[model samples]
Target: MKTPQIVELTSTDIDQYIDKLCTILHANVHDGASVNFIVPFSFDDAKNYWKNKIQSSIEKQERTLWAAFEGDNLAGSVQLDYSMPPNQNHRCEVSKLIVHPDFRRRGIARKLMAQIEDKARELKRQLITLDTVKGSKAEPLYLSLGFEIAGILPGFSRHPIENRFDATTYMYKNLAAKFDG
Candidate 1:
């Protein structure tokens, strides 16, 4: 696949790509990605999530979303949430890094992550945090990207397709050090 073009998405852009975004989310959930959904998840569920939850956050400027596109197709997306309290303004959270399964192993997720990290730095955030299902494919990716494991929460989340619970690993990167003297 050709290199995807990563673009920061505005509220309008979110509306325009709502269906593609929902498709990616639905596919990931069904593919057993621990993305807060279960096997019976439906297309409407994904649409509601993007429209109701994510779109509002974008409009409120509480979070920034980025999408990776390859030849008019949305290959992946990720979000950077910086809507912390005033005391925590220096920190941000990375969430919902999803790539279409068909587009996996093509560096789409990495590109999406790079976009969000750049956005975090632009917003003056010094700390970037995220959580992933322990032992999931995303864990190694996060570690490879310089995120250090902060802690692991036992039985923190339910597996998307299975009845068993899954542990979650919280990871963080300290961007402050990179910018410090």
Candidate 2:
């Protein structure tokens, strides 16, 4: 697969790519993503969630939405939540990192995350925080990318398939802003 381009999706782009985004999200949820949704994630549910949560947040400049595309096909996406108290303006939270099931193992998530971190640094944000289901695929990825596990919240959320609760791992990276000599 050719290297996919990352696009900062505006509302119009979100409207255009919402279907693909829902598809990827649905697949991830059903695949035990533990990303705030259960296994019966329907297209409508995902669409509504994105519209109300992501699109509005982006328009309000409280969040930044980015998508990865391969030849016009949406491959993956990640979000950065920059809205916070004034004193915490240098921090942001990374959330909703999802790649299409078919596009996994091809470094789609990695590329999206790299872009997220770069954008944070560009904005002079020195701290990035995120949480994922403990022991999920994402935990290792976050760790590999230099995020340290801050703590674990037991029963943070329930697993999609299992009725039992799953722990959540909160991680953070204190990025040093790049300075040009």
Q: Top model by lDDT, which number?
A: 1
User: Candidate 2 on 78-132: residue-level lDDT in tens?
Assistant: 9999998998887999989999888889888899999999999888898999999
lDDT by residue (1-181, candidate 1, tens digit) is: 6889998899888789998998999999999999888889998999899989999999999999999999989999999999999878889999999999999999898888888888898998999999999998999999999999999999998899989999999999998867452
Q: Give the clash count for each candidate.
A: 0, 0
Instruction: Please report the candidate that would top TM-score against the real structure.
Output: 1
lDDT of 1 at 48: 94
Local distance difference test, each candidate: 0.92, 0.89
The C-alpha TM-scores of every prediction are: 0.96, 0.93
lDDT at residue 104 of model 2 (Cα atoms): 88
